[model samples]
Target chain A: MSINAYLAVGLGSAMGSVLRYSVSLASMVMLGTHFPWGTLLVNVLGSCLIGWLAATASRAPHGKLAHWQPLLVAGFCGGFTTFSLFSLETLHLAQQGSMGLALLYGIGSLPLCVFSAWMGERLAFSHPPAA
Target chain B: MGHGITSVLLVALGGALGGIGRFAISNAMAHALGKAFPWGTLCVNASGALLAGWLLGVYGVANTQSLWLFAVAGLLGGYTTVSSFSLQTLELWQRGQAIRAALNMVATLLLGIAMTALGWWLAQG
Candidate 1:
């Protein structure tokens, strides 16, 4: 990849990570850390956004929004969503014997995030006809 | 060095390094392991989880806001990803590899957590 590409990914990831931090803190305040609603919210939202961006990017003729694909989708959305913390938090819950909550979070994450992405893709195709 | 700008800059710099490192490692892994399975992302996420757990366990959430922003939120956050994992799983299922997709999902969740706990426990000791 070019230096520009690296810079784009880096900058986008930085912004995304910061947003994630804010969301996590807010979620903790609102929902409590009993469950990781923070990471889940961002993960689901980020997946959906990346899906929308990916679909939009794919439909664009040629490389019309080439730079945008990496900056927004790969860098921003990817950095915004995290699987590691989700896993760790779930483990913490389970290890502490909160098996129900752990299972709920684990089972809920995959389908919800995947469906959100699907919805995003559908929304992208719904309006503003693909180029 | 107030909270607003310094925090943002720290996270940004850490994220940039994390993102770059993730790209390099993933590329290297793909080169070595092939793209049939997403071993690269799996490794990255697992290692990121481990480090994050260790950092939190060792630091203990007192006066490490900047460090937390840089390491946990920025570095590990950028290093690991959920969107790619979800998309890859979807793609695998779409390609008729249902079993592989399921295995990937289960293994990632199980292993990621296991490694994180391991790291936390190690740091505690």
Candidate 2:
């Protein structure tokens, strides 16, 4: 809404993107690109964080934390988790005739991300209500 | 460029630029296309995927960690999104637009992946 909001999103997105890169690089080193574990990890983690923040904000008494939505939800999570590259990677796998792997990846991502977010929301609200 | 503090900074800067670009493009598309469907997000995701594929193909993945950070990780990553997509799909389902919700989810995934492969294929030539 304001210039400040834009700045916050931009800065948060920058940090999130950097973190995504680091995680992906680390995953590649530790595991291997045989399965796109890096993107999966980031996407699920970002979903979980966003869900937690959104749920927490909804239960908060004040709207103060709402202001950070753009920065955390729209910018950070959005930047950290990428649908584009996920799709791209799936396509690559399919093109390589690893149709089984591609199908596994495709079917796996949506449910995993959605469930992660749901878990996050539940986790945040599962605790006793804040006084 | 090697992976170091400078590379991180470069990725950060690229991410900033990409995030701003995504915000602007999505807003502009929403203004033009109306808000019935998330055309803005779809466009962003699809294009970002294509670009990621092409960039990786062009740059190669062996010795270009910095380039990967700046382009694929920072720029394309910032430009694309999954959170918004998930939120929107949930919203649509909640609102009883189950069909559109399914359409959005399926189409974006299918098209995004297809386009990425196309970009990668093109880059080979």
Candidate 3:
């Protein structure tokens, strides 16, 4: 990565992280602590946005937007979601064709996603994520 | 930060910082790991869940005021992600990477929860 790359990621990380915080906080307040509405909402929203960005990037494929490409792609999406890793490791298993591992993991994630949020709230709402 | 202009500015700044941080980290992970699976995404989500839990637990006993909220919840949590988690799982399904898809979903979800619990447990202790 060049200096531009570093700057782009830096800029994107700051904005993405802060925006996520604000929205999620608002969601928590507007919603409730019983569930992890904030995380759920942020995760979903961020994913959709990234999907759109990816599509857009593919289509145009040029300009300052392109310059902002990595920033948005690696930086924003990176900031916004860990989807890359999810895709990577899962795919790694897929290539190996470890049906059992893959299938079991996929099924297990359902509760996990909920539980993570639940625990987050439980920690925060019930106890909190420590100082 | 007040609920007025200052709060708005603070919110913006925090979002900007978090956004950039997320982008930077994800990029680094993607590069370091490679482009086959999504080690980047998993790590980010896992870390975020862990940190959020830790911070929340601490805030309960100590101070996680609005500013702290802006920093930790907004900045770090925001910089990290969960959305990518959902999307990637869906993408795997689309590509017919069934086993990997399933594993991806399960591992992230289960691991994420476990991590959150671990973080909380550590904080509480």
Candidate 4:
């Protein structure tokens, strides 16, 4: 990777980590630490954003957007979307008389996300008829 | 063990980078292939899982304090994502691709655990 790439990843990672922590803390305080909304929010939002970027940005030729994708998707998204928080949340939910909720959350989250991914790809891959 | 300023900070930092990382990978793949499936995400999550399994097991077995904290807890834990995988599988099943989805789940869990064991053995050896 080039220096620019490294810099992009590092900077995005730093920011992403900070956001993950902040949201988790906030969620823990308000929603309670038992389950992790922070990870859920981050993953769900990350999927949507990634889907949108896939749909909209790929059609255009590479230029400024080329560099931007790494910073946002690879760096920030990679850093932000974590499985650890997912495990913690599920454990907490199970412990808190919400075993079913935890299971559903764990089971349902990724597939729901796949739909978003597919939709994004479909939208992006498809083009308007010679407008 | 829970609720520390440092841990919280790490999560946020990890999240931002992870989010961006996903964006970069998926978008790039989408652009290159001109396809409708999420090859990027699968690549990212699967690769991340392999690396994490290796990393987590190495540190866990070796009992290396530094590795345990930095590599295992901070890096690996921050890297791989069960959430994305879970969400992906659900979508597949919902779309009536139940077989593929089930296989994906089973494969991920089994292979991930096996890789973790491999890493542990390698580290201990």
Kindly state the number of residue pairs that clash in model 4: 51
**Of candidates 4 and 1, the better by TM-score:** 1
Evaluate candidate 2 by giving its C-alpha RMSD to the native, one decimal: 2.4
The digit string of per-residue lDDT tens for model 1 on B1-125 reads 35777877777777777777776677788899999888888898889989977875788543248888788778888889888777777667778998988888887887787788888888898
Task: Report the lDDT of model 4 for residue B21.
Answer: 54
- What does candidate 4's lDDT look like per residue over A29-110, in tens digits? 7897555666677777666656655445555546455548657655665565665444434434655689788777766665
Which residue pairs of candidate 2 clash? none
Interface C-alpha RMSD after superposing true interface residues, each candidate, one decimal: 1.4, 1.5, 8.2, 5.1
- lDDT (10s digit) by residue, model 3, range B6-52: 55455456555765555556668888888567777677767766765
TM-score (second chain) of model 1: 0.94
RMSD of each: 2.2, 2.4, 12.5, 7.2
Q: Each model's number of backbone clashes?
A: 0, 0, 59, 51
The CA lDDT of each predicted structure is 0.80, 0.80, 0.55, 0.56
Please report the TM-score between candidate 1 and the true structure: 0.90
Q: Candidate 4, which segments miss by more than 4 Å at Cα?
A: A91-98, A118-131, B1-74, B81-102, B109-125
Between prediction 3 and prediction 4, the one with superior lDDT is 4
Q: What TM-score would chain B receive for each of the candidates shown? A: 0.94, 0.92, 0.80, 0.64
Best by DockQ: 1
Error of 4 at B116 (Å): 8.9
- CA lDDT, candidate 3, residue B54: 64
